[model samples]
Target: MVIEYSGIVVRSVLTDKREKFYDSKGIGCYMFRIDEAEVVDATMHGSAARFINHSCEPNCYSRVIHVEGHKRIVIFALRRILRGEELTYDYKFPIEEPAAKLPCNCGARRCRRFLN
Candidate 1:
């Protein structure tokens, strides 16, 4: 595994409130959803892994693991990674309407053009 996507575990319902709070404070928010019921709020408490960007064809991938009865998100290498290479993984964001689509900038040859 490359790293654990660590942060304060929170209920999915509270994410909106927390995001708004961070926005009001002008702090960038970092989050990783574990499922419909939980999310990891990495805005204030996170590691360098939080800064990893998204790629259409990623060298890494994330997986949810249950440890001690609690679920955790872990980033793992999808293949061999060379030293000094930037780590990336697919965000796999849900598809949205054309008006709400987020553009992809990973620059991969197979890039979908849109992140969602």
Candidate 2:
């Protein structure tokens, strides 16, 4: 499926962990803020989002924006994203605000201890 935002067509993703409302596929999940929908909380799952592998030095970054009074998660291309490239973002927030670690197979030169 495709998610239409403004005039942009973003991809949609569905995986096994939709019950949690969001799940990271070693890649990332795009989320829509709670205010976007009545039934969901501050976050809703992006079912068509892709599974881009993780990298310590990532080429993409996730940003939360307020759209139509709703907060939405968008993956921005920090660098050039080639066709067929898997989109990835840094799961680690910051050194002081660290998230739990998950097993990582992302094989980057500077792979983190977890995928988060």
Candidate 2 backbone collisions, by pair: 12-48, 12-49, 13-47, 13-48, 13-49, 14-47, 34-41, 34-42
lDDT tens digits by residue: candidate 1, 1-116: 99999999999999999999999999999999999999999889987889999999999999999999989899999999999999999999998888999999999999999889
- Model 2 stretches astray by more than 4 angstroms: 1-45, 93-100
What TM-score should be assigned to candidate 2? 0.52
Write down the lDDT of every candidate, Cα atoms only: 0.95, 0.49
lDDT tens per residue, model 2, 1-116: 12221212222332234424444434333333222232122223323343444677777876566779765556678877788777766755324425454666767888876665
Lowest lDDT 10-mer window, candidate 2?
1-10
Task: For model 2, state the Cα shift of residue 27 in Å.
Answer: 17
* Per-model TM-score versus the true fold: 0.96, 0.52
Best candidate, TM-score-wise? 1
